[model samples]
Target: MPQPHQADGPAQHAAGRQLPAPRTPSPRDAPPLNWGVIAPGGIAGSFVDALHTHTEQRVVAVGSRDPERARAFADRFGIPAAYGSYAEVLDDQRVDIVYIASPHSAHFAHALQAIEAGRHVLVEKAFTRNAREAERLIEAAGERGVFLMEAMWTRFLPHIDVVRQVLDSGLLGEVRTVAADHGQFMNPDAAHRLFAPELAGGALLDLGVYPVSFASMVLGPFASLTAVGEKAFTGVDGQASIVVTNESGAHGVLNTTLFARTPTTASISGTHARLEIEGDFYAPATVRLISREREVLDSYVPAQREGGLCYEAAEAARCVAAGRLESDLMPLDETLRVMRALDEIRRDLGVAYPGE
Candidate 1:
C-alpha cells in the first residue's frame, strides 16, 4: 500500500493542481486491512460506499441484531460475510477492524467489545453518550494495546490538511474567530431510532459534532465554554448555541439543530482575512479565502467518485501498517474534547440519554 503524500497549504492550488495526489490504497497489499461493520445504518452505508472507492480495505463482514437486515446490508455492498450478532463479527478471526455504527448510546459497549476481542475499532461520533463513556472506552483500548478512533470523518478530509497548511503558512494570519453550524430537518417518526430516548436521540450528538469538531480542530481545545439551547418535544436538544473562548481569547460560535435546516456551512476569520467553506462543508468540500480587496484562496472539491469517507479509512490502514495506535490529526484526545463540549451543552439543556 502506497501511503498518501503530505498535502501542503492552500498554495498548492496556486500552481494549478486539479486533483490532490492523495494516497491510493488497495487491499491487494501484502498486509491487507479487513473491516467489519456493526449495526449498518445510513452513515454505515455511506462508509461502505466510500470503502469501495479505495483499495487495501474491504468490508469483510456486516453485523446486525436482525439477521435479515445484516444480510441486506451485506448484499447491498457485496460483502463476503453477514452475521446476525455483533459478537459473531468480533469473533471472526479475519476481521482486523470493527466499525461501531450503532446508535450513540451503543457506541461504548460495541467499541469496547471489539477492542477486547483484539480488533481495532472505529466508533462513530458522537463517540459515546457522554465524556465519561468516551474515557472508559479510550482507557480500555489503551489497556488492551489495540487501536481506537472516533469516526469524526471531517478531520480526515483533504480540506483539513489544506486548511492546516494554509494556517501554518501564515497565509491566514492571526486567528480571530471560527463560526460553524451543521443542522438538518429531522421529522423522524416518534419510534425512529433518531427520535427515541433509548437510541440517544438528539441533534447535539448526531449533527452538532461536526461544527464543534471543526472549531476545535482549528482553535484547539477551548479554555472556556458558555452555551444555551432548546429541547424538542421529546426533551432532546433540537437546537443549541455554544460560545467557546480559547485561552488566547479567540472566540467561536457553534450551533446545531434538528428541527429545521441551517446552512450546514462554516467559516474561519483571522486578523488579516477570512476563509469561507462551501455548503456541506463536512464532506471534503471547498473553501474560499477572502481578504480586503482580493479573493486569494482555492476551495477543494470531492477528490473521488464515491463517498469521501474513504479518507479516514485510508488513514487507519496507513497507521495500522506503521504499527501506530492513534492518528495525529484526529487523535483520541481531540475526540474526547469535542464530546465533552457536546456533553456540557446537553447537560446545560437537561437532555439526558438512557445511560445518563
Candidate 2:
C-alpha cells in the first residue's frame, strides 16, 4: 500500500506527505475596478454584496429594464447610480467592467453590446443559449480587444486550486471517472422562469451547468456524450442525466434536476486513489483524498465566507488590470467547449428554446 506523508501545515497527509498549499490571493490584493451591473437580479445582488464586503472593487452603477427595480437594487447595494436601461449603464464612462447577470437567453446580446461599447464583461454561466452564440460573443470580444470571462465563480475558489494541485501531483494516478449532481426543488408553475421555454427555463442551463463545468474541469471536454432527460409541462427539461467520455477513455457522469433537491456532491476516481467533494461541491466546501483501499490520505476545508463570489470578481479585476483579454483559468475556448457539450445534451433531450 502507498503510504501517506505529513506536512508542516494543515494540508499534511497521514504519511509525512505535503501538497503545495493553494495560492489564492486575497480579494483585496486585486486592483480595484469600477464595475457596472447589467441586470439587477438575485445573482447580481449576491455579487455586489460579495464585492462590497470582501474586495476593493466598486459597483458604480446598476441597470434594469424597470427603472424602479434598478433604483431599488441600487439602494439595497448602496450603488451610486441606477439606469432605466442597460445602454445607459454602458454609456457611463466611469464603469470599467460590466457584469452581465441577465437571463441565459439574453447573455449573447448583452455581452455583444458591452463588447461593442468597449467595456470588459464577466457574463454569468450558461454563457449563452448555445455554443454558436458563445462562439460569436468570443469572436466579438477578441476582435474588440476587450476582456471577457464567464462568471463560473467556483473555478476560482481556493478549494478548486487545491484540487488542481492534487491532480497535478499525480497522486490520483489517471483520473478515470467524475460524478456530480445539482438539484433544487423549484416551483413547477409554467409561468415560473424555471419552466418557461421562452426564458430558456431548464434545469440544464441553470443547475446542470455546475456539474457539467465541474466535470469539464476534471475530465476536459467530452469526446462523446449521451444524455437522457424528462421534460416539464412547460416543454423544458426538468431533470437530466448525462454521460460523457473523453479521448482518454475517462468518463463523467453528471445529473441535475429542478424536480427535487439533491445532495449536490461530487467525486473523482482514479487508478490509485479518489477525491470526494462534500455536498454543494460547486460552492465553498471541503474535500477528502482517499487511497484505493479507502484510507483517508488528506482532507481540506476552506475558511468559510459569507459568499465566495468575491474570488471570481477579484480574478477578473486582476486580469483586466494586467491587460489580459481573457482569463487563463476560465478561457473563452473552454467556455465554448462546455457550451457545446451543453448544446449536445439539450439536443439529445429534444429540448429547444425559442429561436433555436
**Number of the top candidate by lDDT?**
2
> Tens-digit lDDT track for model 2 on 155-229?
999889988877766667788899999999988797787888987989999999999999998888788899999
Candidate 2 residues lying further than 4 Å off, grouped into runs, are: 1-19
Q: What would the per-residue lDDT of candidate 1 be over residues 25-112, giving only the tens digit for each residue? A: 4323425589999998999999988877555588899999999999999999999999999999999988998999998988988998
RMSD of each: 5.0, 3.3
Q: Candidate 1: lDDT of 185?
A: 90
Task: Provide TM-scores for the models.
Answer: 0.90, 0.95
Which segments of model 1 are wrong by more than 4 Å? 1-31, 294-297
